[model samples]
Target: MNFKGKSLSLKEYNDLADILQNKYGMQFLGDYEALCSNIAAGKEEEKNQAKPEPVIKQGQGDEEKAVFIRGTIRSGQLIRSEGNIVVLGDVNPGAYLEAAGSITVMGKMRGTGHAGTQGDYSTYIAAFRLEPMQLRIGDIVTRPPDGKQYKSKVPEMAFVKKGMIIVEPYLGKR
Candidate 1:
């Protein structure tokens, strides 16, 4: 499954195809079994896929960076960015990441990450896992608990709660 540097699969790209094809239908295509019947199935196939675009134009003033990185950050790699950052692949141990805003991992991160590096408490960091060697936000830092319960779990998010960082479950957008 090393699809790194590759385009998204048709299946992965089409998960929300039906939703995109409908704007104001009485019944959404994915709402219920019966509701799906009324929606035009062909619409999904007819809709054109929108490719990604850069957040900032090349000639834009001030040159704001909303996101940085598009590949695996292996062990020992270090990334210091002023805006949000994304790792399209795994982040191996010994890697260091610092972002002023949120950080998203379309893959796994097993290194050290510090979102809110600019003291932005609103920062959020998410990966295919929350099992990093260390996680931090602003001036607060916490290492993954060295126990069985954490080592076996899946991907999650880390956010501040009660003036402390608390790792919690993340179900994508929800």
Candidate 2:
């Protein structure tokens, strides 16, 4: 190809490709010889195929079992459930929790939390100390206000209302 208006030799082209691959984890598709070889060997099709979406199994009936977590969910941890999720401990930053139903954390929630993942907007998220980095309920997404968050003495809950996610103080209701 051309570089700085000069025709680049094969070696220079490959060297540039290697640099790009190493620095950015990107494939350089300009190597015709390699492409032809890969295509002939049927490896190109495998590499180009799109990844399949994940399938979530449904419960036997309309009621699904809730998942209960009993310890601190530290950073980098991910939790997912088909039904509701109840965490008896804290969820630290960089962690994630996703559920098709509601999410209830008895302790602090300072990570990413998603509830109603299956398009059920009626689900909600409740936490004793709700200061999550991000929150999602159904298709709506929200984040903490861009300033210091006030710590509430009472637990807080989030739900979708009027196509927007709203946070409100949760009063225990049997």
Candidate 3:
């Protein structure tokens, strides 16, 4: 009865509904679109209402805390972590992320990523495709140049350099 942990398209949902009704004699209360919308709304509500729990793991000689996210961050969502943060998906526009440690995105970043939120300038933000609306490290911030477009789809890293946030293409092993 629960569809959690599964990603299904409209057609797939409809097919499942049909199978359930025909084979199991189970009746669905709402239409396909309505059901999907309700599920999405519920998820958004849960995210908005839920509080982030601290994650702790044993490191080489101490305990390290990090937050890991596996899905795209939509607009209006804010992800704040007391330690490092790693996102496996893209960060959409209007979304925000603040972390006391480094922030890493396995996909594109088009939102605001504020690393070193606790004033640790050594922290950095790295993404597979960096085209963020804003990048912040400690007290420094950087934005895309006016009327400038980055054509390369290479990975990039941003860090505080000389009191300013500098973003450069990530070569290997930095």
Candidate 4:
């Protein structure tokens, strides 16, 4: 792309191309000048479109907040929350879930989940079927045993134990 007649470097061009393709659904067709013009046109169209106002509930703060997802997390999708995350459906492979406090899945969890991402190892991950592709707690990262599919009828919880992550049966509240 040209900025006041100055051309962009290859890396900068690639980055801008990625933004255009991913954000505006524009495919690069060997015409940099046309791509830039299309981007400008898209921005103008967006400016003319009406947008809904966001809602904020009173008395709720970030530390006390938890993100709740009601459906399956598909591949290539990522969900991140600053507090906690609770998913009502399965987390499919290639999906990613990250939270600062804890992560809870009401159904199968076959994706990558990172809880306590801010280094709070006390946080845990619980799921009805804890069969994740990978898991990270605090600074520790681990993957499921090689070649073994998880087949459990009960819920399970994973937490930090002795500087490592350990999985155990999630036998409800005491």
Candidate 5:
């Protein structure tokens, strides 16, 4: 916090890292694995006793890579990640998910999934259950059948074909 001042004490730096780790699942700073190893390898005490260098590096590349999400996309849940999004559990109806790349939901999907919100035409939506009220990719839009959970099967992926969205099973080729 007080980077302008003299070098930061180890306690101060470590406290800051701890705060960031607790506040956010993972700090935007460099990987914590090395730090953990340093502490576990008994070098932490030595490093802490001395003035610790500034952690200059931040998160690595692949910033646009798909984010592997592992949870149920519950109602009122809004998941917006930079790259592709993958959900391990079901996505409730009222929830919303918008990603730059493709979206794959392992569990039931009944929410709104907007792929290519950043304007990529090749983006897609894949879900264990595709029964969304609406879906959009690039400049195309599509709505599922009227009945509740009609022809939509257990595993389906929706993509634009001939300026229209076509939902297909994800089990085999094509």
Candidate 6:
């Protein structure tokens, strides 16, 4: 399907793909690079159609607030928040998430998550099933060791410890 001149969001694209796959049995054959390019083009078109507005100054209280998102984050999508972020659904591969504060995924996480984007080393990332492609906290970045796999799919949390990222099972009510 040609998406040129169309401004469909990532979720819309995912929904369309699902319908095509399930109903028509046609798989989307585009690569990640092509999908990203299409998304970028749609965003650019949206920016051109919308008028510029003055930057809104956020109060100190807003910095402590959290952003909540519902639904799966598919590939070629990016999510960012100034404060904490909580996703109610899975974060699929090729998706990116960034939060200045902490990040919590209620479902599986199989994408890139960057916490402490504003240099808050104390920020952390938590997920029901942690299988991230890459992770970052503050200025440090890490990935699973080559060929390393977790035996258990338990809920886990990641945080910076002694300048290194550490992942551990989430023990309740610590």
TM-score of each: 0.59, 0.62, 0.62, 0.62, 0.59, 0.62
Candidate-wise lDDT, in order: 0.68, 0.82, 0.81, 0.83, 0.72, 0.82
Ranking of predictions according to lDDT:
4, 6, 2, 3, 5, 1
User: lDDT: which candidate is best?
Assistant: 4
Query: lDDT by residue for model 4 over 46-102, one digit each (tens)?
Result: 788767333222222134558999999999999987778999999999999988878
Model 1 deviation from the true structure expressed as Cα RMSD, one decimal place: 12.3
In model 3, how large is the Cα lDDT of residue 15? Answer: 92
Pairs that clash in candidate 4 = none
Q: Write the per-residue lDDT of candidate 1 for residues 49-134, one digit (tens) a residue.
A: 35434332222111256556788898878887667778888888899888777677777778899988767666777887666889
Question: What range of 10 consecutive residues in model 6 has the weakest lDDT sum?
Answer: 53-62
In TM-score terms, candidate 4 sits at: 0.62
Question: Which pairs clash (backbone N, Cα, C closer than 3 Å) in model 2?
Answer: none
TM-score, candidate 1, is 0.59
- Backbone clashes in candidate 3 total 0
Candidate 1 has its poorest 10 consecutive residues by lDDT at 54-63
Candidate 1, residue 81: lDDT:
67
Off by over 4 Å in 6: 1-65, 148-152, 172-174
The true-versus-predicted C-alpha distance at residue 142 of model 3, in Å, is 1.3
Q: What range of 10 consecutive residues in model 4 has the weakest lDDT sum?
A: 52-61
lDDT of 6 by residue, 37-156 (tens): 867886797799796442222321124456899999999999988777899999999999998878899999999999888777888899999999899998999998877674346899
Point out where model 2 deviates above 4 Å.
Answer: 1-63, 172-174
